[model samples]
Target: MDPAIEAIRTFNRFFTRHVGAIDARFLDTEANLPEARLLFEIARQEPVQANLLQAALGLDRGYLSRMIARFEDRGWIMRDRFEADARTRPIRMTEAGREAFDKIDQRQRAAVAHDLNRLDAVAQDDLVQALTKARLLLDPDAPAEFIIRSARIGEVSQVAARQSILYAASHGWGRELETLEAETTAAFLRRFKPGREECWVADLSGTMAGAVFLTDEGDSLARLRLLHVEPFARRRGIGGALVDECVRFARDRQYDRIILWTHTVLDAARRIYAHHGFECIATEVHHEFGEPVQGETWQLRLTA
Candidate 1:
C-alpha cells in the first residue's frame, strides 16, 4: 500500500479511538459505523424519511433497514410508516437519543477545533484552502458537459424549495420556508424583466445542481444573491463557474460594483467569494432562525 494512504488509515483509526468513537463507545455493535452515522444524520432534523437517508448516504436498502431496526430496538430511534406510501418509513430521534448525540457531537467539534486552533490562523486557512483545492481536483469525475442556462418557471419552485431547506437546516430557521418561498417567487418573477435581474442555472447530467442571480441595485451597484450549489454537485466547478459568470455579467452590464450578503458560518462560500475578489465591506451581529449569526456583506469592484 502507498505510504500516504497507510498513514491516513492509521491516523483515522487513532483519531477514532481517542475520540471514544471506535472501540468501547459509539461504534461497538452489529450496527457498526452505518448505524452511528445514521444517528448523527437524523439528529439534525425533526424526522428523516428513510428514502432521504438512503439517497443522501447512498446506502443499500437492506443495510439501512437493518441499521435503523437496531437503533429502533435500542430505543434510540423510532420509525413511523407513511400512510400515503406504505413502503415509505421515516425515522426520528428520541429525546434521550438526541441528548446523547448532541453530547457526542459537541465533544467531536471541540476536539477538532482544539487541534485546528493549535495552528496559527494563516496555517489553518492554508490547510482548509489546500483541502478544498484537493477535493475540487479529485471531484470532477462526471465527464458530461453541464448545461448552463436561465432557470425556468417550472423548475424554479423546486430549486428554491431545496435551497430554503438547506438554509433552514443550517440556520435552524423554522420560518425560512415562508420567507424563502416569497424570495424565490420574487426572483423568478424578476427573470421576466431581463434588464433588472439575471438568474442562471447549471444542469449536470439532467439534474440542476448550481444556481446564482444578479440583481441590479442602482446605477453603480449590482446585488448577487441566491447562490447555491447542491451537495452532490459541489467541488465540480459549478460554484466557481456561477461566480465567474456573475463577475463577467456585472462587468458587461457596466455595473461599477457587485455586493453580496451571507452568514459567516458558511465558510466555504465565504472563501469562494473571497477568491473571486470580493472584499468584506460590512458585518453585523444578527440573530436569525434559532442562532446568533454574523451577517457579512462583501463587495467586488468591476473595472472596465
Candidate 2:
C-alpha cells in the first residue's frame, strides 16, 4: 500500500478511537454514535426534511424512517406536514428532543475541554486551527460565515501583499502577480471616489478571507478588480457574494455596465460572474502574470 494511504488510515484509526466515535454509547449517553449524531443534525437544523437528513448522513431510507419513528415515539421530535404541500412532512425537534440534544452537546463539550485542558494554551490553539483546516480541506462548503464589510484604508491597502502571499503557496505565483495587484490597488487608493468607488473584504474570524474592488472607468462603466478568495475560503459562496455585492453597488451608483478582467485558469470566479449575468465579451492570449495564458473579459449590462 502507498505510504500516504497507510499514514492516513493510521491517523483515522487513532482519531476515531480518541473521539470514541465507535463507542456503542457515545459519551456515556443512551444513544449510540449514529443516534447521537442524528440528534445533533436535527438539533442544529430543525425543521429539516427527512430526505435531506438521510442524504446528509448517507443513511438508508428505511433506517432513517425507523430512526424518525424512534425519535417521534420518544417525544424527541415531531413530524408535521407542510401547509402548502401535504405530501411533504418536516421534522422538528420537540422540547424533549432539545433537552436530550443539550445533554449530549454539553457532555461532548466537557469531554473535549477536559482533553484540551491537558495541553498548553498554544498547543490547544494549534490543535483547534489544525482541526478547522482539516475540516475545510475535506469539505469546502463547511458552513463558515465570512463577515463582508467595507475595507478600511489600512486594511484595503494591505490586500495586495496579503493576496500575493495567499496565492503564492497554491499557484506558485511570483512578484508579477504581486506587482499587478499592487499597481491596481495603488491606483484605486490614489483615485479614490467617496461614494462612486469602494472595496469590500470578506473577513473570517478576523482574517481577510477574500476581497474585491469597484472602480470608476470614466465612461459610465464600473470595473471589478482584484477579486479573489483564499483557497481555504472557496466553495462557501464568498466569491459569488463579492461579485454580487460589486454588481449591486454598480447598479446603485447608476453605472451602465460592470466589467471584469479574469484569467481562463479561474473557473470558479468565471462561474460566479456568469451566474451574476456577466457575459464574456472578449478573450486573448496574454503574459500579464509572466505566463502565456488565455485571459477573459466579462461584462454585465446594468440597464437590464
Candidate 3:
C-alpha cells in the first residue's frame, strides 16, 4: 500500500480507539457515539432541516429516518412542518433531549480534560496545535483566523528551526542556510531594541504559521529578514500579511527605506514585495547554501 494511505488508515484506527468508538457506550451515555453526535448536532443547529442534517452527517436515508423515528418515539425530539412549505419539516430537541445533550457534553468535556491533563502545559499546547493543523489540512476551505503579533520568549529559536526546515524541503538547501538563519535570529535577539527593531509571528489558531523580522540596518534603513510561511499554512495570505506587517512597522519607525535579500526561486515572496512597492535594487550570482543562485536585493522607499 502507498505510505500516505497506510498512514491515514493508521491514524483513523488510532483516533477511533482513543475516542472509544468501539465501546458499546460512548462517554457512558445511553446512546452510542454516532447517536450522541446526532443529538449534539441537533442541539447545535436547532430548527435544522432533515435534508441539511442528512447532508451534514452523510447518513443513509433509511438509517436517518429510523433514527429520527426512534428519537420521536422516545420523546427526545420534536419535528414541525414549515409554515410556508408543508412538505418540509425541521427537527429540534425537546426539553428532555436538551437535558440529555447537556450530560453528554459534560462527559465529553471531562473525557477530553482527563486526556489533556495527563500532559504538561507545553505538551497540551503542542497537541492542540497539531490537531488544529490536521483539521486545516483535512478541510482546506474551512475558515481560518490569523493574528500578527510580537514574538514571545523561545519563539525566535522556533521560527529559525521552522525556516531551516522549510527552506531545506522546498529548495533543497543545505545546512548552510540553517546556520545562517540561527546566527541571524540570535543576532536579532542579542541586539533587540524595543522600538527600532521587531520580530512578528503570524499565529493561526494557536500555531506559529509564519514569521518575519525587521531590523535596523543603519542610515535610516530597515531590513526585512527570514520571512517564511509554513507549507501547511500556505495560500492563506499569511506570507503577504507578514510582509505587510514588516512594511507597516518599518514605516511607523520612520525608516527612510526598507530592504530585503531574496532569490529568484522565491516567486511568491517576490510578488509580495512588489505588491508593497519594493523594487529590485541589485542582483548577482552567489554561491551559498551549497548552490549557485541569483541573489536579488529589493528596496522600498518609505518616504514616498
Candidate 4:
C-alpha cells in the first residue's frame, strides 16, 4: 500500500476517535453523528431548499427525506412554500428546533473547549494549525494558491529535513533516505549556479509548502530532483507549478532535456509530471525505502 494512504487512514482513525465520532449519540445528544451534522448544516443554511440541502451535505435523498420527516414529526422543523420557487418548499427549523440546536451547539462547543483547555496555549494553537492544514490538503477542489521563490538561507537544509521527516513518518523510510536527501541538498548548495541551476520552494503564506531542485548536468542535460509538496498543500497544483518552473528554466538555459527519478508510490507527483509532458522512459524495482519499490525515470525533451 502507498504510504500516503496509510498515513491518511491513521489520521482518520485518530481524529474520529478524538472527536467522539464513534459514540452512539454525539455528545450524549439524541442524534447520531450524521443526524447531528445534518441538523447543524440545516441550521447553518436556513431556509435551504431540500434539493440544495441534499446536494450541499451530500446526504442521500432517501435518508434526508426520512430525517426531515422525523424532524417534522418531532415538531422541530417545517417547510414553507414560497412563490419564488414553486417546485419545492424551503426547509426551515421550527422554534423548538432552534432551541434544540442551540442547546446542542453550546454543549459541543463546551466539550471542545474543555478538551482544548487540557492542553497548553501553544499546543492549542498548534492543533488549530494542523487541523487547518489537514482540511486544506484533504479538499482537492478547494481554491488555493502558492508562490515560487528561490530557496533562502537555511531553507535548503529545511527542505531536506522536511523530506526526511515526512517520508520517515509516513512510509517507515529509514535514515538512509535522510542521508541521501542531506547529501543531495549539500551538493546543490555547494555547486550552485546563479542561473544555470536553481531550487524553487513553494510558499503558502509564509509556510514552506513544497520544494523542487533543478540541476544542470553537464552536456546540456538537466536533472529535476527532490520535488515534494507538503501533505496539507497537495492537490493544489503546487507540484505541477514547480515542474513548470523547471521546464521554463531549462528552456531558458538551453538544456536539451530534463530527467527526474521518483518512486511509483508517488502517484500524485507522477501524474503532475505526466500532465506537464514528462514521459516515463525507464523503470527498475529496488528496495531503497524499506520496501520493494519501482523507481522510474521520467524525461521531457525540450523543443527548440
The C-alpha lDDT values of all candidates are 0.74, 0.84, 0.88, 0.85
Q: What is the lDDT of residue 277 in candidate 3?
A: 93
What does candidate 1 score on TM?
0.51
Model 3 TM-score relative to the real fold: 0.92
Instruction: In angstroms, give how far residue 234 of model 1 lies from its true place.
Output: 1.0
Model 1 gets an lDDT of 0.74
**Could you give candidate 3's per-residue lDDT for residues 130-246 as a string of tens digits?**
998898888866788999999989999998899888888888987999899999999999998889998999999998888999999999999999998887788899999999898
Model 1 worst lDDT window (10 residues): 24-33
- Please give each candidate's TM-score: 0.51, 0.57, 0.92, 0.56
What are the candidates' C-alpha RMSDs?
19.3, 6.9, 2.1, 7.4
Give the better candidate number (2 or 3) by TM-score: 3
As a whole number from 0 to 100, the lDDT of residue 2 in candidate 3 is 100
Per residue, candidate 4 scores C-alpha lDDT tens digits across 100-204 of 788889988998999899999768866875665766766745566679999878888988899999988877788889989999999989989888999899987
- Any residue pairs clashing in model 3, and if so which? none
Which rank order by lDDT, best down to worst?
3, 4, 2, 1
Candidate 3 least-lDDT 10 residues: 81-90
Best by lDDT: 3
- What TM value does model 4 have? 0.56
Better of 1 and 3 by TM-score: 3
Q: For model 3, what is the C-alpha lDDT against the true structure?
A: 0.88
The deviation in Å at residue 269 for candidate 2 is 0.8
